[model samples]
Each structure stands twice: as structure tokens, then as C-alpha cells.
Target chain A: MSPPNALDSARAFVVDDEEAVRESIALLLRSVGIASRCFADARTFMADYHPDDPGCLVLDVRMPRMSGLELQDELNRRGWTLPLIFITGHGDVSMAVEAMQAGAFDFLQKPFKDDDLIRRVQKALEHDRAQRQQRRGLTELQHRYDSLTPREREIAERLVAGESNKVVAIDLGLSERTIELHRAHVMEKMVARGLAQLVQMILQLRGSSRGDR
Target chain B: MSIPPLAPDENPLPAPPAESARTNFASEDRLSALLDAAVDPIVLIDSAGRILRFSRAAERLFGYGSDEVLGRNVKLLMPQAYAQDHDQYIHRYQQTGTPRIIGIGREVTAQRKDGSTFPIDLSVGEFRSGAEQGFVGILRDISERKRQEQELLRSTAELRLIFDNAPTAMSITDIRGHILDANHACQVLLGYQRDDLLQRRYTDLTVDEDRAALVADFLSLNAVDDSFSREVRFRTPDGGVLYALLYAGVVCDIEQRSLLMIVGLIDRSALFAATREADELRDRLVHAGRLGMLGEMVSGIAHEVNQPLTAIANYANAGRRLLQNGLTDAAELVSILDKIGSQADRAGQVIRSLRSLTRKREQLRERLDCNALIEDVSRLMELDLRANGLRLQLKLSPALPPVHGDAVQIQQVVLNLIRNAAEAMQERRGDEFVRVTSSARARAVVEICVSDSGPGLSAEVEDRLFEPFLTTKAEGMGLGLSICKSIVSAHGGELLYRRGERGGAEFVLRLPTATE
Candidate 1:
């Protein structure tokens, strides 16, 4: 049985020049209880698409005014986050390779089974939601972490480095009791349950810095 | 006798003792007159190397007065380059007295007063007179004879050069049609050793079927004209047939009556190949054009069909899920819908791929990765490869950079190369392999090598492999490699071939990389 909250039931966009492909993909999305918008081509889709909405895009690889890949590049350039599923007629493996390398969610050849396409779209949507949530959590973490005073940051860094209150106090040229109060504030601000959790959060923040770049 | 009677001043009789002196004076006068009247330039030189007497002709020839030349050494008349050798030559001649370049007659260069040298025929005579011994040298200028000899040598050398290197095949035969001379080209063209063809009759070399016709043609031409021109086939020593246009003519050679035939080969094999290639390319272009037109016509049908296919699939899936939940009402409809949906989509996909392959837009030239293109085309042709029971071995270098080319077009070239290699090895007795490999070469070039275990190209066809529409296959149009060459050249690359290490024909394509 299909899950009720399967991302196939999420909002979606169908972008294509062919009328039948556009209408059919929209119908398919509706059958899965997903709200979808249809446009004739990339230009029409771009003109009407709302950045605030969280949805996946079903784009034709080849289009008249703008190609689907070029649209993906432009969206990326504008920092707009959306999962992309390419539907190709002449699906060369090279193009598929390139699309995946460029971070496309999935690529489906023409005349693909509706279930296969729907399943891929559903997977892409799920992935997109998880990424969005991760980004939100990261942003919230960064905001809270950035609000810490320099002294509190020093204490947090020292605690994460496995230094005791006495070592951190000596390193920062502060009192041991003052270091203890700052460590408590670091844990509270980062929403950690304990010193171990706080250290884990600090390590996670450092690890994510490498991945984001 | 009557003038002797005059007795005043002319006939005054002297005393008897003075009579001998008068006779001596008369003899000296006679000798001088004889030397002056000679036609050859004569010079009389004493043993001390002094010019005692020089005739009027000698004075004119040596550019000097008799008085000035009388006491000078002969060295004064020789130019500086010849002067150093004159003394040695004179000494040698004097010592040997064997007439090395003197005595009876000899040809040598003599220099006049102005320092210009001319060929001269000289004869030196040795004689002993009463109180001194002297040499009488007779000289004749022969500049014109020397010029004629030089001109003859130059023309002979030029003729020999032409005879050796002429591109047309030439054979010299005797009056009886026996081959007497075969140039290098003629030997190679007829596939015969020089010794084998020598003394062989021309009729023996002609194809047996055409010998009668050739003989008739030759005789008819000889009857009307001195030369005969006819197209005939010649049998090679190795049993191969070669087409040649033979032009034979009768000529009287110095030693024998001979016939010289200059054969010009029209080389129609390459031409016929090119023509076939052009025809095939035209067909392919027409096929592509028709495909494009057909695509436009069928796209509407394709869309209409795709819609129902998608609907059927969706309905079938929904029914399948519903039946999994223990609902049997929609189960029968599901299998029927699945079958229809699968077939419709399959048809739609075939149409889609066909249209895309032969789309209206011409292939655009750009920098592309050959490995990527090969992978794409191979995937598209996977079904064909499998159906043919062929295996494709790809050895692509991972770090291969992009080569300057049209990706789609080069993919077509690679496809043709691989397909031809596979087809060539279709019925090979042993293990068959169609190996495709790519490597970077010369720092800025990429090479794609395609080799197969097919029967290698014949020496004959290998030379004209890229000529259009020449195929060994029964159903081939033969435009594959010709179009491939055009594509390669359009991208500033070269396609080449040879017999593979594994006993098959190998084709290698070299393309310039983007940086190159």
C-alpha cells in the first residue's frame, strides 16, 4: 500500500512544450493526490513559478526557448531550492550522466511507466523535504551559535576539545568558576542535554562546515 | 733567263769568294716566307723557350705582334688557372716524349691575351735545324665542337631521367610483340618481376578472354595509324587482373624494330568507390530528411497514444494495489490494462528514439568527450549488439579530456566504426571480439582505436577504404567510413587503419583535443 504521506502526494510542477505531456503529467500528479501546475515551456514555468512554494519540478529535457538543464542552472544561480526530475525523449546516457552530476534528482526516459516516474518523483520530493528541514535546522543552529559571546565561544571550543574547566580557565586566562558558567551557557544556547551532547553538537557544526562548502 | 741579262745594279757580278753568302741569304728569306704563308697558326720556338718566329696567323690568334711574341715564354698566353699546370704539362711531354697531349694531334684549351680560354686542336712538331733545334706547334680553335658535345650529353641525361621516373606505365616490345623493356612502374602495375616479364610476348600478359579482341584492336589501329590505343585487362603474375588503357606505337629503335606502348591507368576503382560513397551519403541524407518529415507527421499520433498508455498504466497500478488489499473486482481489468499499456509505451518509445536520432537540426560542432559520446551511442545500440551475439570491449581512459568535435556526429562515426568491425568478424572461425579503446597521444590529441577479429582488408581495398559506398558486405551501401572521414576531417582529425595484431582490420581515429 502507498503511504498516505508519500511525497508523490506533494505539490509539483510539470514544464513542457507539448500539450499532451504537460496535461498528462498534471493528471498523473492529481491522481496521486498531489497538487500540480502545468506550463507550456520553461519560460512560462519560470514566469509563473513561486519561489516560496515547496514542490518538485517535472521538466522536459529539450524545450524551445530554454532547455530544462539551463533552467536548472539558472534556478541554482538564483539560490532557489527545488528538486528536479528530467523527462527526456532522446535520453542519451551521457545527458543522464551530466544531469545527475549537476545534481538532478532523477531522469526518466520518454514513454516511461507512470508508476516508475511517480515513484522517482515521490523519492525526489522526500529527499527535497529532508534537505529543506536540514537547512532550516542548520540555519537555526548557526543563529543560536552566532549569538554566543567570545568568552562563551572559547569555553565551548575548549569543552569540545576535551579540556576540563581548569584547563579552559588557564587557556582563556579566566577563572575556573567563570569557565564553568560559560560552559553551561554554551550547552543551553546550543540546546544540548549535557556536556557530551554539547561536544557532539559542536563537532556536528564543524563537520557540516566542510560539507556546505 | 731573259731578266738575268741585266748587268747594271741587279746583275752586278761579285768576286767568287762572296758567292756562298748570297745563296745563304736567299735560303733564309725562303724559310720566312713559307712560315708566313701557312694557314695553321704556327709558332717556332727555340730550345731556350724563346719564340724565334711567329706567323701572322699566330700573332692574330695569340693577340700579340710578332716582335712582342718573339722572345716571350708560352706561359704569357695561358690564363692563371691553367698557367700553373702548363709548365708541368710541358715538362711531362718533354720527359716522356710519348705525345701525352701533343705530337700528332690533341685537343687542349689555349688562352689568348685577354684571358679567355677556348678549345684548340694542337700538333707539336720536333725538328733539328743547322745550329738549333726548335718546336713547330700548329693550333686550331674548336670552341663550337666542344659546345655541341656538351649539349648532346645534357639532352641524353634529361631523357634518361624522364624514362626512369615517368608516372605512366611503359613497356618496350620488339616488332614481334615480345616485351623487351619494363620500367619500374610497369612492373608494379602488372605485378611481375622485371626478369619474368622480359622477353615475354604481350599477348601472354593479356587476359585470355580479351587476348583475341586486344590483338584485333591493335592490328586495326596499326593498319590505319602508327599507334594503337585500347583498354584491356592484364593478368598479373600472381593471378590478379588489372585494368589498363594501353597505347602502343611502332618505333625503329637503334638496334631493332620495336613497339613502345605507354599505358595510362584511369584508376576507376577509386572513382567508382567515391561515386558509390556519394550515392550512399545522399541516401543517408534523404533517409534522415524523410525521418524528420515523418517525425512531424507522427508526433500527434505519438502523443495521443502516449496519453492512453499512461492512463492505462495508472489504472492498472491502482487496480493492482486495490487487488493486493483483497479487492478482486478490478483484478481482471488490471492484467488487460497492463498488456495494452506496455505495448503502447514500447511503440511510443521506439518512435521517440527514431525522431531524436534523425532530428531536423544538423549536428553542431563543439568540444566533447569521446568517452561520453561512445557510452551514449553504445547504450542506444545495446539491443543491436546483443541481438547480433556480439561483445563490445571498451577500454576508455578515465582522464580523457574533451576533443573538439560534434558529439552526436562523432558518436555516429564511432558507431559506424564499431558496427563495421563487428560485421567484418561475423563469421570468423575463432573467438570474435570488437574492441574499442581510447587513449591520449602527442600530449594534445585523443585516439579512439577500433579493432576486430574479422578478415583483414585486402591490399587492394585498403588503399581505397574511405572512398564512398565501397563495401564487401552484400547489403552495405559503403558510405560508413567515407562519412566518417568527412566527420573526422571536419573536426581536424585523421582516421587511419591497418591489419590488427589479432589478424583483423583495425581503424584508429585521432582527434585534436580542445587545448590543442
Candidate 2:
């Protein structure tokens, strides 16, 4: 039931108030050669969970004391981007809609086929890995952008805005040759092999700084 | 025979020289006419017991003519029993000059012309005319007065018999609250002896709380036929309380003056207790019916059953996957099989509990942990809360003392409160939550509070929140809170509503501890 490109270190975290449901989901994941951890309630899961973990969370939508959705809200408040897959016994349409609107990766009704769950878990895991990779790439781009000189950063911003070297030089009251030299350094430091890639990196960094993950 | 003078004097007063004999003759004629006009029957007898004269009234009363008994013995007018003793008595009295019937009037039996006996009043006096001594007896018939006296005696005895044998407790009291007479049943009902009860006042037997009202009712009875009735509690000699319906009325004389108050008590303690029990049973039935009709409860039960089934399916499918993967771990396979079996049992348990809840079974009182009861309800309500976009937070105390009540009924109360909280928060937009807390309170009570983070109750609703048929919801019957209150009160507990600290409604249910 494992996806073709399933990562070796990726795991599945199962949280449910029902012991039988929590353990069985973990067992199903184990059968597919996927390592899994289980929690009896949302609180225990929250205590040991980290957003950096390369995994997807399998959560029971209804739990005593603190429900799965509340835990998801807490995670969102903390700015953690852990992928969530909600499982509900009632298959409540309104609950599914709410969970989806709250940025849930997927919602599955209880008594779902093993293949269906396995497929969703794999897809969620893939999404989590991809998000983490993009985050890492952005971090690397931020570091390289920090390495640029002040003049190169100014030219980089103008270049990403579709400004020509001649216009940028005139606007900054500098020579076109000086602006061209700064632009070349900006591209090299940003690790963009082309103008399109450099512009994309600059835009990505701008979007992240505006809290648009 | 010479006619005896009508006068009783031994010697007539010497006539005035100027008066004539003719004047005396005229006065004598007038006196003879006056004797016949008397209303009472009058008869005159001589010293030898012979009748000397029978007046016109005497002739009619004895059923005889005056001429027939002019010289007959007076014994003819007497019954045989008195006649035999009368002749000897007159002879002895004449010889000894001692008066038996001479100057004293006495009642004696008399015989008439037809030989029927009647009662009469008789008096005799001696008179002499020139040494010819004679006794004159005057007689008056009194049969009518005797008949009326006998009639009064019989009816009084009948009234006494009826009062003593009546089933209702009855007592007659003076206007001052003093008991004048008490019947047999009154003694038994009050748990007192007849003599002891008579000494007690009506106010003495009445319970302290009802004493004032009873006194007021008694004092207000001033007119003939005035009456009042009410349910009252009385304290018996053995320190037991009795409930009774008291009916009291004033007894009056012919002159319309109130004489006494007659009280009747009908025992109603058993009836009152039965009615209370019936009310409790009806409340329980209504609660069960409400639970059956709740849509959220049905969905919650469905979700509960699905949980274990889902777990069983997951285990089964995982085992199949293992087998298909060519796994050889026998221990793991056995564990998976065991888990699937237990999960199936879990689902069965949920269904069984649900059946017990919805079934209209006799309410059974048993010791129950409040925390456990809350947890059971929380399990059933979790799915419903989620479906309504609400969250539930439980903070059950770990060591709460057990409460004694019907388990199903108490759980139903808790479920109702949770559902109400959820419904209250339906109009809320964000961060909706219902919190349930259980803890041990002072005075050996277990407290469970269900509060919501929704709009608090309005002033109008808070006043009559537990009244039946008072509803804020469009489709609600409004019996939920009222039934819950009744159920709790039946179990010797209290259900109270107050504004929660979170600016929402909070319901506190406090049950007496089982040990208490």
C-alpha cells in the first residue's frame, strides 16, 4: 500500500481517544512498512509533537476533553504547519467542511478501506515533505540573499520588478555599468541560474516575509 | 240528701245585717257556672272516695256523662293498680287525720270510661258542713306532656349511636378550641384513648405549622351552618405525622346561636405519598421518552458504535495485508486477531448501553460515581458536539464520593444539560465550547456543573428556567430542564441555574452522597 516514492524516515502519528482505533491504524501503517506512533488523546500527542517531524497526523475528529480540531487550532496558533488527516466516525458533513476550511490536508470517514487510508496518508506525507523542502529552500535562499552587498540587494529588488539596468542606474544616480555589476552579483549570490529563477526566489522570499506560507 | 255548701270554711263569715239571703243564693249560682268553663278536666270526690261532682271538662275527658258518676267511687277513674291501694289509703287517712293526698298534689294513673289508662294530677282537701265531714279531690289530665318527653329521649340516643359508629374521625369542640366530645374513630385516628383525647384541645393535636390556620378557622366560625375544610397535618402521640382532610362545621340551637364545632377528619397520608411516587415515575418515563426522541443522541450512539467497528475493520484489513505480504510472524498475527475480537466486543458494549438507556425500565437506585457518569455522557456527546461545531472540556475530580440514584436517569440528566449547552452555543460564531466539571462539595454532596461559552440566559428566562412548557427553541417541548430538575429532586438532590463565569448559563446538579 506504500506509495512508489515514499520517504524512508517519514512516519504516521495516530491520535484517538479510543485505544482500539488508535492501535489498529498504527498496525495498518506498520503492515505497509511505515513506522507509526500512537497517542490515546490529543493532549499527549500535543506534548510530544513537533512540526519539524516528517510525517502526517491521523486524528480522530471527536475526542473527550479536547477534540482533534481544537488541537489543530492550537497548532495553527503556534504557526506550525503539520499536515492533518481527520477521521470521523459520524462522517458529519459540516465537520468535514469545517476541518477542510481550517487547512486540513484530508478528511476520511471511519470504516474506510485500508487502501484508501494508506493512499491519503502517503499523499499527506508527500505534501508534508514537499512543504518542508520548500521551507528549507527558502531558508537557503534567505542566507544567500543575506550574503549580498547593500548595493547588490537594491539592484536585485529592482531587477525582480522588471527594471532594466539602464533605468535602475538612472534612478539611483549611478552608472549603468555599476548597476550591471551589482545585478550579476545578486544573481550569483541568490544561486539563480537564470533571470527567471532569480525573480522567482525574490518573489518567494517576499511572500514568506508577508506571512503567506 | 242535703246539698253540701260549696265553701270550705267551717263557719261562714257573719253576713252583714243589711245583706239579704237572696244575694247569697245568686252568688252561689255564678260560682257553679264558673266551674264548667275550666280548660283542665276537674273532678270532686267525697271522704268515702265516692265522686261528688264531675264538671263539664271532666265529663269529656273521662268519656262519661256527669249523671252516671255522681255517687260512684273515685276508684272507677283509676287503673286497677292504683285503685286497690287507694281505698285503704283513704280509710287510714280518715281515721288518723294524717293527709296523704289531702293537701299535696301528685301524679297517678287514672282509668277512663272505656277502661284505658292515662296520667293525671290529683289533690284532695277535707270540708265539713255541720259535722257531716267530706273530702273533695280535684283532678287534671297530663297525657300530652308525658308523650313529648319520651320522644325527646329516643332521638338523642339515636344521634349518639350514629356519631360513635361513624368511620370518619369526628369531634365536637367549643368555639374556644376545647374538645367537648370525641367519637370512637377520632380516638383511634389521633392515637389517643377516649378519656385522654377528651382532655386535649383541637389545637393540641394539630401540627405546629398548621396551628395558626386551625385557630383562625375556628375563631371565624360565628354564624349558624358556618363551615370550613382543609388538608392539615397532625402529630400523633407516638411522634408520627399524619396527613388528613379536616371538615368542620358549627352546630347551632333553634335560636340560631352557635353551640359547638363538629370536626371530621379523613386520613390522606397514604394518598399523598402515593401521588408523590406516581409523579416521580411519570417524570422518569418522560425523560426516557425525551432521550428516545433526541436526534443528537441517536447520532451520537451511531458514532460510538462505528468507532469500534472501524477499529475492527482496520485490524482485519491490516492482517490481510500482512498475510498478502508473506509475513511469517505468528505472534503478531495472533495479537491482531485478538484485537479484532475485542474491538467487536467494544462495539457490542456500546450498543448494549444504548439499549439500556432508551428502554423504559423500572428505575433502580444504586451507588454511582459522578465522574463515571459524566464520562459516559461525554463519550456519547463528543460526536454531537463536533457535529455542532462545538468543543467539550471535562475536568472531573478524581476522588468524588459516589451518589445514590437511578443510573440511567442521572445519566439522562447529564446528557440533557450537555445538549442544552450545545444548543445555547449554536448561534455563536467562534471558539464555541461546552465545559463540564464534577467535584465533591461540602455537606456530603457531589456537584456536577455544565457551562457553555455562549450567550447567557436573559433575565426573563433565568426566572422561570425550570418551569415546564417554557421554551426558547422553535421545536422544543421545553420539558427538558423541568424534567431534569424533578429527577434530581426525587433523588434528594438539587438542580440550580446561574450565570457562568464565562458570561454563559451554568447548571449545577448536586446529589447527596451515597453514604449520607
Candidate 3:
């Protein structure tokens, strides 16, 4: 069999204490040519984890030592951004609400159809990839914004806050021409080719910084 | 009947309890020849107690010659201790004419020529030898008769000892059923003193229901030579009734008259009650065992059925995928169909085994192959063994004979044993084995031993292993082994267990081969 292509390398990691469950889920993924790794418990999964690896996590909710929610918190603490889908034997309402509120991508109860699990894993992998790209763009934007002079940086913040160039100049008691020139310098340093693109970059940076917080 | 050698004017007199006196001793020389021919040793003594003659028999008995004893005091043949009394008796008899030494019998010790003293019966008679008054005493050696009587006494005492110490309680009752004698065991068995029993009739000790029977047996003894025995309820001292075996026969005197009836009793209350209780417990266990087995079957039902269900689903799903891909081969389709069909059938078989478990049927004794019975049970428990990470080793002897038992009950026993062995290793993992071995042991018994590799039971649990509801497991009702033991014993077998060589539990069940 040929190895998985790079685009399909965003593997799904499955953690469950039940050997049969892990094997079945992995077999289902393999049937559709999706790569997957399996671990019997959270500790073993954590021990073998590659922080920079591109994957999604499929975990059981009610594990013995380390529950799925606890593992989610552990992943967040380590600053890893893998999206997770939970599998629960007891799919009670309160548990579902708690998992979803804690940012679980999705959860499916046991004896679920193979299609349901495969779809969730694919979606989680897609979400994680998109988040990775967003973070990279945010980091580049923050670097360019850091290069601005103090006055230019101040003007740039006002621009990102939705203040027009004239309004920002009036509030800072500067001449409209100086505000325009500073805006021009700000757009150059941040590499925004258009006003709309500059606004979108600043918004993306805000969302990513909020997520980091 | 009269004493020998009477005087001329005397009348005949009767001899005493030691009777049968000899006569015809009229002349000295004739009497001398007569005395010599007599079987009893005889010595002739005169009125002064001097010996006149010693016959040849007397000489032979006293180890002396007649010349040596003649003209001497007859006391010379008497023991020295008796000499003074003998002389005085003779003096008194001559003075009073009371005839103490004549026409009367006395027992005295006679001295031999060697000075050894032996008992003899001496009788004296008054005789006249040409107007001289003299006493002719006839002496007899009675040692042989005394020895024979002593031997008879000793034998009677020995028989009495055997009767008194015998385990079978024995008593002798008169023809009227009144107790004449009772041995020690009989007294203890009836819980009565010898005097108490003697005061009451033998029928009084028996319950009212059995009184007539006992009396009939006693009354019929006179007509029967051999003993007649029957079981009767006899009253104890504390008012409780005990079952006893009574054997009665008549003991008769030599004149063919009934003397007493001998009755023998044995206490069978304890033995009889225990046997009854055991039979009842066996029936109850058979019921309880059915319930216990049902619980185990229900508990493992999912796992047992899930395996085949999983396989069936996999096969069906695989075939569906193949068809969806438009890549189905006829051979592959047929193979997949076969697997799905058989797996469903396998699940159905488990359900049928459950039906067998639930059937509360009576014990139907069937001659069954022991090895095959084991195979059926293990097949039912295949999933359970796998789920608990246990490996089963079956070492059934090929030449095992068929055993007579209730197949379902024996199946319950095997199921309990295998399930217990599997549960014992629930906490352990790989390399653990649950081994079942069947062999034809000595005495036509087939034995099955279930041994495991898990840790054996604790010391406290080992002590009370088969006690109901005393279990080591957290969820255990603990009647499993107890019910198994009852089932085995009810089939005329035994259930036994011990610590295994590898520190696990080993349970051995032995059942007898079919008698037919």
C-alpha cells in the first residue's frame, strides 16, 4: 500500500481505554484511507504526543484516571491547538453541555455508526488546520506592527478601532496631513495592500490574541 | 440310700444331699476286697481314730503302702491343720454317741505321702468287729470334680462379660415380658438404672405404638428357634424417643421349659436423622443451583452473544462494502454469507443454553459422556473465559466411561466451577490458565479438576469455603461452591478443593460410573 499523501497526513489520534473500540474506530478510518493512531489511555497518548504534529484528537469522555475534559485542559495548558471530538458511553445532557462548553468539537455516543465518527474526525482535522493558518498569519501581523514608531503605532491602533483618519487626527490634536502620512507609513510596515485587507488583518490578530488569552 | 456297715439292731437311714452311700461291707476281709475294688479311695478307721486298713486305691491315692498307714491314727492322712479338730470330734462322738463321725459326710483336706494336701469327702460308719466298737470311715478324693466346676464358672463369667460390653444393647426378659437381666449397654440405651428396668416390663420402655410389636416379638420367641428382630421406638429417660433395633429369642432350660427371652437393641436415631436431612438438603440445593446458574448466565449473556454479534456485523458490513464498491466475487459472497449465517447460529446456540439453564426439571438420571458434558459447558463459557483474559486447557481422558447423573445438574456443576476459576483470575492478565481435566480415577470414578493460575483463596475463606453466602468476592453471593458440592454428592460423588501447586485454587469433582 502507498503511504498517505501530505494533504491526508493530518491524522486522527484516538484514545480510549477499550481496546475493541480503539481498534474498530481505527479500522473504520483505515477503510476510507484516513491515517489514524490509537492509544489505550490519555497518559500514553500524552507521552507519545508531538506538539507540532498536525492532527485531531478523538477521546473517550469517561476515562478512569484522566478524563477527556481534563485532557483538553492539559492540551490547552501546553498551548497545543488540536481540536477534539469526544466519545461518551453515557451521553447525558449535562455531560454534553459541559463538553461542548469546554470547546469539544463534537461528541458521539457508543455503538455509533462508522460514518458519524469519520465525519467528526475529518471536520476536527479541518478546523485544526484552519486554526494553525490563522495563528501563523496573526504572528506575522504582530511582528510587522511591532516595527512601527510610537506615534505611528498609536495611529494604527485608532485605525484598527474603526476611527477614520480625520477623526483620529482630531482626537490626537494632530494635523490631518500628518495623520494621512502616518497612516500611509502604517499600511506600508504591516504590508496591507488595501484598506479592507488592513482591516481584516487587524481583526484576525485580535481574534487570535483573544484565543491565546 | 443308707450309710454303709450298719450295726446289728439299727434301722436304715437316708443319706443327705451328698447321698448315694455304698453298702454290703459285713466282713472285714470281704469289705477289704470290696474297698480295694472301689473307684473312690477308702480308708478304714476304728473308734479311737486309728487306721485299720488302707485299701489298694487309698494306697495309690496317698502314695503309701497299707502296712505304713495301718494301726496309725487316721489323722495321719488328714492335713495337719485338721488333725486336732478331727481327734476332738472323734472323742465327742464316742462320749455323746451322737455319731458325728459315723453315718455322716464331711469334706476335709487329705495329706498325701509327699505332704501335699488335697480335698476329699469322708463318711464314717459304726461297725462291730467281734464286739469291739469301731468306726469305718470312707474317704473320697474330690479334686477332679471341684476343678471341673471351677472351669464351668470361668466360662460363664466370660460370656457375661461379652454380653455386658457389647454394642448391641441386650436384655433378658421373663415370659411375661418383665426384664430379668439387662447388660450395661442396654441400661445406657434405655437411659435407666438396672433396678428401674427390673421394676418395669420390657414393653414399658417402648413407645405405645411399638409396645404391641415388642410384646409380639417377645411372646413369639418360645415358638421360634432363631431370633426375630425389628425396629422400635423406645423411650429415653428424658422423655425423648429413640429408634432401636430389637432382636428377641427364647432361652430355654434343659427340660425344654422357657426360661427367659433375650432382647437386643441398637440406637439408630442419629444415623437415620442425618441421612434424611442430607436427602432434603440435596433437593433444596438443586433448586438453588438453578437460580444461581441463571444469574451467571444472564450476567455473561451480553459478552457471550456480543462476540458472535460483532463477527456477524463485521462480515455483513464487509460484504455490503464489497457490493457497494461493485467488486463482489461469487466465492467471496458465499463465504461471507456462510460466516454471517453461522455466527447468527452461534448466538442462537447461546440462547438455547440459557433455556437449558432455566428449565427447572426433575433429576433425570442419564448415562452421559463426561468429556462431552464438559465440552458443552466450556463452549457456553467461551466468551467469558476470553473476556476475563483466561485460557482454558481441557485434558479429558479419551477412555472415560459414562456416568449416571442429571445432565443439567452436572452441567450446572461444571459451569459453576469454570466460572469461578475464570473469576479467580479477573485481576490478573496474560499467561493465566483455567485448566479442566477429566480422568477415570480408581474405583470406577471419573474426576474433573479445575485449576487456575490466579492467587488462591485466603486462609479464612479456605476454612469456610463451601458455607453458603460466605464469599471472598465483592459481588459474590458465595453459594456457587456450596451448590456444586451438593450437586456432586447428590450424584453419589464428592466435591473437594485445595490450594493449587501454582498458588491458585484447584477444585476436584468425582462422580461414580453408571452402575448399569
Which candidate has the highest lDDT of all? Answer: 2
Candidate 2: regions farther than 4 A off: A1-7, A90-98, B1-209, B216-305, B326-331, B345-516
lDDT of candidates 1 onward, in order: 0.69, 0.79, 0.75
Compare the candidates by TM-score and give the number of the best one.
Answer: 2
* Candidate 1 lDDT score at position A168: 77
Clashing pairs in 3: none
Provide the RMSD of all predictions against the true structure, rounded to 1 decimal.
21.9, 21.5, 25.5
Q: Could you give candidate 3's per-residue lDDT for residues B164-271 as a string of tens digits?
A: 888778888776778888999999988998888984787887789988877787666655365788988988889988887777776775477767677778788887
Query: What CAPRI class is candidate 2?
Result: acceptable
Give the C-alpha lDDT of model 1: 0.69
| lDDT string, candidate 3, A115-193, tens digits | 6776787788778878777667777889997798999988887887789988988999999999999999989999999
Candidate 2 TM-score, true structure as reference: 0.43
Instruction: Give one digit per residue, the lDDT tens place, for model 1 in A1-213.
Output: 134465433577888886655665665555565567888888878888777677799987778889888999888888787999988663245676777788888998766887787788777777777877887777888888898998788778877888889987887788988887887788888898998878777777887898778
Q: What is the Cα-based TM-score of model 3?
A: 0.42
Using lDDT as the measure, what is the rank order of every candidate, best first?
Answer: 2, 3, 1
